[model samples]
Target chain A: MNPTTLKLCLMAVLSLVGIGLYGLMICRNLIKMVIVLQILVKAAALGLILAGQMSSQINLGQSLGITVIVADTIVAVVGMALAVQVQRRLGTLDVDALSSLRG
Target chain B: MLEAILFALPILTALLAGIQAIRTRSLIRSALWLAGVSASIAVLFYMLGAHQVAVIELSVGAGLVTVLFVFAIGIAGAEIQPQRPIVPKTLAWVLILVAILLLAGFALPFATTVQHSTEPETTSVFWQQRGLDVIVQVVLIFCGVLGLLGVLAEEKAPLDQPMVDEIAAERERDLRNLEYQSSQSMVSSQQGQTR
Candidate 1:
């Protein structure tokens, strides 16, 4: 595809990312919130890849995105473990249900 | 034309996936949709001459982030559906129109890049100058692994005794009071009998 078309694609993707962020913000669930945060980060990576086509100096967007993926894996595993614990103790995953130690 | 079709397909799929994800009823469904969107974006990256970036996006953004989101969903549990129509339909339409206009204004300027694709890749930043980013990513992954391990080690509650020391102290005080009271009562009874 031509550069101009690719540019448009990137712009549209960014706009979608913006909308996803809005959804994440408005959504009440904590897990949904985490996913939304991930989408936002992915949007930044998209920006990085698009920028690669423009400037000659900033090319690590791919590597950075890869690294983020690896890091995020660890985050997911830990989050899962925490979820299991929360479910065991509290019997429900509702973020609103937790009110024990409010200071 | 084939290239354009290829590029357009991925972008459309990505956009649709993202939109579907955000609009889905459940967190699990939403996460899966987001994964599809990330995969499409990765393909789009490849079309843009950023091969490594595409790989990373697929593996990390698409793969890892999706997994993390699923885990979070499990932890948080399924959320109840929120009531909609809170925002007026007119406001929603207005936002959509404004978004389209704003996007066009921002993107129209970039249309000229299509006329200039033949510029040679002059920079070796990906292979040469990007060492620091790679290193940082490696470190971040390592730390995330360690953090996960730490989270695992920390159980729902630490297995140690709960307030045992305080109980022991209270028990010792009670025993002392009992001993003193018994001794005083015994002495008073003996004195009264002697009198």
Candidate 2:
């Protein structure tokens, strides 16, 4: 990747990270939070790819990036499932209501 | 020229999708936007020559994650009120613009060169150096299934007499409806025979 391309990729990562942080801070919905986490995961993956490209360790970077992607999918699936169950039992998807862990 | 455009395409797509994902109020639409981000990232990976990682991202990110989000939204059955997304949206854009200006002012002066591999094949490293990561990935997926099962496992609800009666009555009505339909079909068949 050229310098411009690299800079663009970095800029993309920063934008995604910023957007994801905004969602995480402002969104009250649990499912949306999980979706925002996915955005953050993509940013991390992109960052890893950029790292690989810069160091010419493409194989190592790709391997790590794939690991990140796998872990992210698992987390998203589990998180969403839990969110669904929370809505079912608590009767609300609001994070404030879920703040208490009283059984 | 083409290389620059190709490199920028996925980045542009991801930035747009990220903004949309953060700003959308509807859970389903937000999930779709996340999928768009994932697909664009996969495109970036492919363009960077990481074919294996790209395929994995395409399958798990774009495919499974989106489906899972939609299913969760379906089950949750909560209407996400359109909150004030403008604040976060504008803040995100402003921060991005600032970061771009800072990068241009500070980082562009060096013009550091990057060295990319000509062969993007990573299967060797995946099995050799990152075997443990793969194992961890499998464990994480298995744990996710277990976690889902744990969450969805419902306790037996105590059945009240009225609730039981209501259920039985509904079942009886359904049975009566089925019987009526079957009898009508049988009678129609006999009429056809007579004809």
Candidate 3:
């Protein structure tokens, strides 16, 4: 990545991280929470790629990025499934309603 | 100038997608915006010379993740309900402004100094150094899929009794109508025979 692109990537990472934090703090819905988390993970992946580029280890960064992508997909799938189950059993999608841990 | 713009396209795309994903009311629309973000990031990956990673990002991030999200939304039966933002509008905008200022302050100094790497082929690195991680990731994906199915497999009663009851009543009415029609047809045949 060029200097401009690197800066852009860093900018993206910062923006996404901020958005993810804000969303996670405020969103009441579980699915939305999962989406926000994905955003955060994406930022981390971008950061890893940027780090790799800076250090002249592009392959290492690419490998790490791949790992991040795989892990994120798994997280998203599991999280969405959990959200579906929560909506099924709890009758609400709101996080407040899911406060019960008895089950 | 064109080179800079070309490189900036994916970043700009990602920014727009993030904004849309955050602001969209419908969960499905949000998921779509997420797809947009993923696709843009894949483009960025490709531009960065990680071709294989870019393909995986496109396939997994843009394709599989979106499908899963859409499926989950379908299962949830969520409406196009507008979510109330956690922060007030003015507050959110103000926060965004602050974030932009901070990002600029942080990134400006490094912008001119970062050098592009002469990257080795990405595939060899994955197989050589990161092989174990790949295997583990594959295992994680398996576990995740199984876990999802396990969660979904557990049967639960319908959350809304009224909707279930309404469906039952509609079915019963249909059955009753069918019976009534059959009985009327039988009686009409007997009358015709007598005539």
Cα RMSDs, all models: 6.0, 13.0, 11.2
The sequence of per-residue lDDT tens digits that candidate 2 reaches over residues B20-103 is 887877788888988899999999889887788899899989998888788778778636875544347677667657755775
Residue-level lDDT for A8 in candidate 3? 66
The sequence of per-residue lDDT tens digits that candidate 3 reaches over residues A42-72 is 8788777777767778789889998999899
Cα-based lDDT at residue B185, candidate 3: 100
Write the residue-wise lDDT of candidate 3 on B166-189 in tens digits.
Answer: 999999999999999999999999
Q: What is the lDDT of residue A60 in candidate 1?
A: 49
Candidate ranking under lDDT, highest first, comes to 3, 2, 1
Q: Which candidate is the best by DockQ?
A: 2
Scored by lDDT, the top model is 3
Residue pairs with backbone overlap in model 3: none
- Compose the digit string of candidate 1's lDDT tens values, residues A63-93: 5555555555555555555555555566754
Worst 10 residues of 3 chain B by lDDT: B150-159
* Candidate 2 RMSD to the real structure: 13.0
1 or 3, which is superior by DockQ? Answer: 3
**Candidate 2 Cα deviation (angstroms), residue B105:** 10
Note the residue pairs that clash in candidate 2.
none
